[model samples]
Target chain A: MRIVAALLRRDLAQMFGSGQRGATLLPVLFFIAVAMLYPFAVGPNPELLARTGGGVIWVAALLAAILPLDRLLARDIERGYFDQLYLRGIAEEVVVAVRLLAHWLSFGPPLMLATLPAAALLGLDSETLRTVELGLLAGTPGLAAIGLIIAALTIGMRGGAALAGLLLIPLAVPLLVFGAGALATGGSGGIALTAAISLLLVAITPFAGGAAIRAAREG
Target chain B: MEPARITATDLACRRGDRLLFRGLSFDLNGGEALQIVGPNGTGKSSLLRILAGLLQPFAGKVERNGEVALLDERLPLDSDLPLGQAFAFWNRIDGAGYRAEELRPLGLERLADVPVRYLSTGQRKRAAVLQSNARRAGVWLLDEPLNGLDVEAAAQFQARVGGYIADGGIAVIASHQPFDVQGLTKLHLGDYAP
Candidate 1:
C-alpha cells in the first residue's frame, strides 16, 4: 500500500508539475467540440445521431486515453528512471498498477466531463447518456491499462505510437463493442454486459502490464 | 561491519549474438572500492548493467544484499523538470537528503529550476552525479561517472567517494580514464575476449 501511494504520488506530481495539464485538458475539449458539432453539421437526425453517438464517443475516449501512453515507459526507460524504480525495492506489478491508475486519472476524468456537452448535443435520451457515462467511467481505466502494456512492449522501438495503437486497438475491440452497444440499446441488459466486460478488462490489465515490464527489463 | 553486499559468480552476458563478457567473478565487500577499466566496446557498461540487475546474464548469477545505485552516462532525468526538481525527485523517491546549499559550489544551485535538457553536457553530468551521491545507496555501480565533470568537481567527487568508503560502503566504478585514488583495486577487462 505504501509503495502504491509512493508511485501514485510520484506519477501525479510528474503529470501536474510538468506543464502537461494542458495536454491532458485540451484534446478532450477539442474532441468534445468536434463531437457536438457533428449533429449541427449533419442535420440533427435523432436516429442517425443515436446510432453513431456510441461509436464516436467510445473512439474519442479511447484515442484520448492512448495519447500519452506512448511516452509512459519509453521516456522513463530512455532516461533511466525505470531502472531506478526497479532498484527501489518496488515490485514491477505495483509499478504497473500505479502508472495505470495515474494515466486513468489524467486522461479519464476530462473525457467524462467532455462527454456531457456532447451527450446533450446528440439529443441522447437520459438513459443512454447515463449508460455512456457509466461505461466510460468503468472502461477508461481498462484502456489505460492495455495502453500501458503496448507502451512497454514498444518502448524501445521506432514508430512506437503507431505500433502501440496497432497492438492495443485489437485488444480494446471488446470494450468498444460493449460500450457502444450498451449506449445504443438503452437497455438494462446492455448496461450490465458493458459493466461485466469492463470488470474483466480491469482484471486482465495488471497481468498484461506486468508481463510487458518484465520482458522490457530482461530484454 | 557486514559481509559482501554484492556477489557475482561466473557471470556472462551477450548482446546481439556477440558475447560481451563471460566467466566474470567478483565480490564487492563493504568498505572496498573496485574500478573496472578497459578499452572502448569492452562491455564495461554491459557489465555494470548486469550487476545492477537491469540486465540478466546469459550464464551464472548475481546476488545483492542491499540496494545498489547504478549511474551511467544516461542521466535518466525528465527533460521537463528543473535541476533542483530533478534532485528533489531523487530525494523523494530514494529518500536522499540534499541541500541547495551543498549543491551551490558546483554551480548547480542557480540552475535549480532550469529544465535538464537545456543544460550543457557537463552540467547534466554533474547533476546526475550529485543526485546519485545524494541517494547514498549501500552499493554504487558507476559507469563512466567522470565523463563530463570539471577538475574541481572530479576531486570533490573522489573525496565524497572516499568518505563513503570510510563509512563501510562499497562502490564499483567503470571508467576508461585512470582513477588516482589510493587503495583502489583495478579489474582490467582487456585480457578477457569479448
Candidate 2:
C-alpha cells in the first residue's frame, strides 16, 4: 500500500507539480484557446455557437489529452524506470494503473475547470454547460486510459509521439460520440454511455499497457 | 537473509534470426562474483539482461532464489530533480534509508544537491551504482559497470563489489574492461558463441 502511494506521489509530482508546470497548464490553455477560436471560425452568431459549443469542447478536450501522450510512457521506458520497478517485484500492471490515475488527475479536473470560461466565450446557457461538464466528467478518464495504452504501444518506434496522436483519435471516437451527443439529445443517456465506456477503458488499460511495456523491453 | 543462487542450463540466445550464443551454463551463489568479458556484439549485455529476467532465452531456463538488481546504460533518476530528491523517491518505494556513506566511495556525497541532468557520465554511472545498492537485493546484474569511471573510481567500485560479496550478496558483471576482485570468476562469453 505504501509503495502504491509512493508511486502515485512520484507520478503526480512528475506530471503536475512544479517540475512539469507547463505540461499541466498547456492542456488547459489549449482548451480555452479552442473555445475562444470556435466563435471566430463559425462566425459570432450566439445561436450557432451555443448549439455546437458542447461538441467543440469535447473535441478540444480530446486533443488536449493527446498533447501529454508523448511524454507519458516514453521517457520512463527510455530511462529504464520500468525495469527497475520490475526488479522490485512490482508488476508492470500495477505501475500502469497508478500512472493512469495520475494522468487523469493532472488533466481531467483542470480541463473541467477551464470549461467555465469556455462556456461563457461560446455564450452557452447554464443547462448546456451543465451537460458539457457532466459529459467531460464521464469521458475524460476513458481518454486518459486510451492515451496510456497508445503511449505504451508506441514506446520504441521512431515518430511514435506523432503516431500516438493519430492512433488515439480513432480509438476515442466512442467516448467523443456519446459525450458530445448528450447535448443534442438533451438526455442523460449519452452521459451514462460515456461513463460505461470510461469504465471499460479504465479496466483494460492496466493489463494491455503492461503487456505492451513488457513487449517493448524485448525489442 | 536466505541463501541466494542463480542456475542456468544450456542457455541459448537468438537475436533477429541470428544466434548469438549457445550451450551456455553457469551457477552463481551468494558470497560469489562472476565477470563476463567479450568483444562487442558477443552477447555480453544480452547475457546480463537474460540473467536479470528482462530478456527471454531461446532455449533452456534460468532459476533464481532472490530479488535481482541491474545497472545498465540508462540512469533511472529523474533528470529534473536534484539527486537527493530523486534518490528519496526511490527510497520511499524501496523502503530504504539513505546512507551518506554509500555516496562516499563514488565521491557523490556533495553532488546530491545537483540535478541529475547536470552530472557528468561517470558521475551518473556512480549514482546508478548507488541506486542499485539502495535496493540491497540479493542478485546484482551489472552491464558495463566500468565504462566511464576514472581509475580511482573504478578501484572504489571494485572494492564495493568485493564488500558486497563478503556480505553474502551475488554479483554478476558484464564488461569488456578488466575487473580485479579476489576469487572473482571470469567467463569469456565468446567461447559460448555458436
Candidate 3:
C-alpha cells in the first residue's frame, strides 16, 4: 500500500509539478479557449449559446483530455521506471491504477472549475452549468482511462504522441454521446449512462494498460 | 539473508525475426557472480533480461528463488528532482531507509543535491549503481553496469559488488569490460549465438 502511495505521489507531482506545468495546464487553458472562441465562430446569440454551450464544453473537455495523453506513460517506459517497478514485484496493473487516479485528479477537477468561466463565456445559465459539471464529473474518469490505455499501447512507436491523440477521439465517443446528450435532454438519464460508462472504462483501464505495457516489453 | 538461486535451462531468445542466441544455460547460487561478455548484439543484455524474468525465452525456462534487482542502461531517476529526493522515492517504495553512508563509495555523497539531468554520464552511472545496491535484493541483474564510470568509480563498483557477493548475494553482470569480483565466472554469449 505504501508503495502505491509513493507511486501516486510521484505521478501527481509529475503531472502537477513545475516541470510539467505546461502539460498540466494546457487542458484547462484549451478548454476555456474553446468556450471563448465558440461565440465568435458561431456568432453570439444567448439562446443558441445556452442550448449549445454544454456540448461545446463536453467537446472542449474531450480535446483537452487528449493533450496530456502523450506524456502519461511514454516517459516512464522510456526511462525504465516500469522495469524497476516490475523488478520490485509491483504489477503493471497496480502502477496503471495509480496513474489513472493521478491523471484524473490532475485534469478532471481542474476542468470542472475551469468550466465556471467557460460556462459564463458561453452564456450558459446555472442549470446548464450544473449539468455540465455533473457530466464532466462522471465522464472525465473514463477519458483518463482511455488516455492511459492509448498511451501505453503507443509507447514505442514513431510519432506515437500524434497517433495517440488520433486514437483517443474514436474511443471516447461513448462518453461524449452520453455526457453531452444530458445537456440536450435536461435530465438525469444521460448523466447516469455517462457515469456507468465511466465506471466501466475505469474498471478496465488497469488491465488493458497493464497488458499493453507487458506487450511493449517485447519491443 | 536467505539462500538465492537462478537457473536458466536451454534458453533461446528471439528479437523480431532474428534469433539472438539458443541453447544457453547457466546457474548461479548465492555468493556467486557471472559476467556475460560479448560484443554488441550478441544477446548479453537479452540473456540478463531473460534471467531476470522480464523477458520470456523463446525456448526453455528460468527458475528464480529470490527477488531480482536490475540495473540497466536507463537510470530510472526523475530528471527534475534532486538526486537525493529521487533516490528517496525509490527507497520509500523498496521499504528501505536511506543511509548517506552508502553513497560514499560511489562518491555520490556531495552530489545528492544536484538534479539528475544535470549530472554527467559517470555521475549518473554511479547514482544508478547506488540505487541498485540500496535495493539489497538477493539477486542482482546488471546490464552494462560499468558503461560510463571513471576508473576510481568503477573500482568502487567492483568492490561493492564483491562485498555483496561475499554476503551471499547473486550477481549477473553483463559487460564487455573486465569486472573484478569474487567467485565470478564468465559466460561468453557469442558461443550461444544461433
Q: Predict model 1's lDDT versus the native.
A: 0.77
Candidate 3: count the clashes.
0
Across A1-219, the per-residue lDDT of candidate 1 in tens digits comes to: 655676787788776664465666666876686787788787878988877776788887776666776767787777877677777766667777778778778777878888888877777777777888888876777777778778877867789898887788788887788777776566666556666776676676667766776677656
Better of 1 and 2 by lDDT: 2
Candidate 2 structure quality by residue, lDDT tens digits, B1-194: 46889999999999889899999999989999999989999898888889989999999899999889999999999999999999988889888746687677678889989999999999999999988768788888989999888898899899988888888999999988888877799999899988
Q: Which stretches of candidate 1 lie over 4 Å from their true place?
A: A1-3, B1-4, B101-107
Q: Alpha carbon lDDT of residue A201, candidate 1? A: 63
Docking class of 2: high
- The candidate scoring highest on lDDT is 2
Compared with the real two-chain complex, what DockQ does model 2 have?
0.87
Question: Candidate 2: where is the Cα deviation over 4 Å?
Answer: none
What's the residue-level lDDT of A47 in candidate 2? 89
CA shift of B114, model 3, Å = 0.9
The candidate, 1 or 3, that scores higher on TM-score is 3
All DockQ scores: 0.61, 0.87, 0.88
